[model samples]
Target: METVKLGIATEYIPGRVNVGLYVSDNGARLIDSGLDDEAGRKIARMLEERKIPLQRIVTTHSNADHCGGNAFLRKRTGCSVAATKLESVVIENPFLEPLVLWSAFPFGELENKFLQAKPSEVDLIIENSGIVDESGLEAVPLPGHFLDMIGVRTPDDVLFVADSVFSEELIEKYAVMFVLDVGAALETLDRLIRAEAAWFVPSHAPASENIVPLAEANRKGLLRVSEAVLESCGEPASREKILQGIAGRFSLSMSVSEYVLNSAAVGAHLSWLRKRGQVAPVVEKGVLLWRKTR
Candidate 1:
């Protein structure tokens, strides 16, 4: 097994996103690229310092903060960009289109200006369980935070788990998480815990040698969110009403944008519950009411 040098980029406050560079006989294969031009420049400099030529750039997901530097690095290193097939669409587009950030939240204007899409084209698309012949690294789909998320497992026993789990600090500060599919997220975390790996490197926090504990904590947090939603409704409530109640409970205000994002997350959870026959949705007075299935 080859010993790979790992570099972490701490873009967000207090939290670091791990972007792995697997250097082997062929060249350097990057695991995940951080958001924006700055991150790309940093990675480029790291490669330059080591005199390693970047051969490929593999992203674990399409979220802005994770794969945001794809375009920049591809432009700079001329490396092919690889991502899950489902995420290729998001990366190519890179924006929450048709959803006006300004009209949606309190920091609408700020989000609108800063959260605009930084679209990039994909050079390679990998399916779930597909092998990425990145000169020396293997990338596999992990799919939890988003439908098309992936994690790269190098020969050195390191698995780059992107945004599927976070540290306690991030969990508390970013109380509200952006998830495309809650059930999938839980399942993905479970898979990560079971997968054979020496280190679980998440894109938003420090890497963990043992991810089971953190995974358990995240599962409990998710359950807490579900319970809070159920209790706030008092009765079966529409998505909007449930979100409003959740925001009130957290002392957080919901903007239109926030509501949209939150609804998508809640809807994913509801979908999962329905699948497990744990919850059922009904129409009451023309409003959709979600109730625990009996």
Candidate 2:
């Protein structure tokens, strides 16, 4: 609802999802939009009240909570949307968000706004050039939390870190944050650990000048989840049993949505372990089972 100024031209509206604002002589560019039409409209109104024109929306990824407001903002402000290749596909399709999570044609239950954001056109396809072309904002490749996620750096030195890391409280509360690639997430953490920025803003966590403690916490949280998977599968286990066991271990009570997301995170950990030859998967009586190889 309120914008916190980070620099002369950069301000971020922090809430359930943080929306970054960067201004220049031409117009304003939103780093990422929040959940839906409501969120988008709120942002539009705030900008309009300040006599600011929204020229573009650079989404970090295709996650609904992050880019869900794109459609509404684009329609209302006629702003061009920009995102990386894979995320652009899901952003334009929208349905793919819930589809991938549901692993097929998603059912009605999984079609909620939190999972399926309204489709928005992508006017620009960002590459790995670091510089996001016309805008000149540096797009740092932040792979792992989602496909082709990037952290946008304004000239002022504030980095909109997107979802590469979770708040320490979230890690303790949820026990497992959804990750598309555990390996990539770990690597991203390393990058954050060594990153130099005047300020780093995680979409979910508060912005900080020193992000090492938070980055280290994320590294440990990821490893803790990976270790839990290894220990749970010491005797071979199906992905479903593994997920449920981890949830039980963390005393987590999940809805259908949370179940699907956490299930995906567990799968990512399995993939990471398999890639390192730390775990092996076998089919037993038609049920796929994973066991720690070493």
Candidate 3:
């Protein structure tokens, strides 16, 4: 066995989920399992090399890439899984609307195939600003990507920022960033920037010594998109119209599957904006119209 190690498991080519295994005198703990059985097996192999017994698996959030390996790892090591309370339900029931699922570009069928939520329960439901009592790790509340999203910090000041920010290549290639709550997402970025972390390790991308610049860029991009939505409507527009306008404006060349995923991402953002009082929606003629509230 290699002992405890920090490994980067690439879920998509050039896109990775960072897994950290903590081996100590007592047991071993894993932070952010990768996206499937294969990924889990790889991590297990690494652990076996280190001769460490896996004891706990903690996720920064419930996104598929972050938690998909949960079941496989749990079955292998019998480690208890834990996540923030807000994401437990969604993680357990990963279904998205069919339309939204199809809207996702490139990998549309992935929504149908992989969007099925895995059956894993959170052994520990972390409250807001709660600490995860695992070896050399701290779980901090970081809600933006998802309602119950969190960041795991190591004693060395390595903060595992899960989908909070992405590499420049990912941004350019994906064109559209998936955010459930734009406002909250920005706020969370601000929080992370202000925190005292030496390295920002994103689950789906490489770590950066300084993430503030990228975070700022992403924030501006989101604000620009929001402004575009407001301008296209001229007046308050329905949620559907706003989404359509966004797609048109971005010139997104999406297949049916991509379209569904994109729709879900837009819907999630709109819902977040509504919750934050940044936007308001009115039902008109059996359709929902959304407008900037503030």
Q: How high is the lDDT of residue 4 in model 1?
A: 32
Task: Compose the digit string of candidate 3's lDDT tens values, residues 228-262.
Answer: 66564467787567777887887767765566556
Each candidate: how many clashes? 3, 0, 21
For candidate 2, the 10 contiguous residues with the lowest summed lDDT are 127-136
User: Deviation in angstroms for 260 in model 2?
Assistant: 0.6
Q: What is the C-alpha RMSD of each candidate to the true structure, in Å?
A: 4.7, 0.9, 4.7
* C-alpha lDDT of all candidate models, in order: 0.68, 0.91, 0.68
Sorted on TM-score, best first, the list reads 2, 1, 3
Off by over 4 Å in 1: 1-16, 96-116, 253-259, 283-287, 292-294
lDDT minimum window of 10 residues, candidate 1: 6-15
Model 2: per-residue lDDT, tens digit, 1-294? 699899888899989998899999889999999999999999999999999999999999999999989999999988999999999999999889878887898899899899999989999999744888566688999989887899999999999999998899999999999998999889999989999998899999998999999999999999999999988889989999999899988999999999999999999999999999999999999999999886
- Using TM-score as the yardstick, the better of models 2 and 3 is 2
Candidate 1 C-alpha lDDT tens digits along 63-99: 6677767788888889888888777876786554313
Instruction: Return the top candidate by TM-score.
Output: 2
173, model 2: CA deviation in Å?
Answer: 0.8
RMSD of 3: 4.7
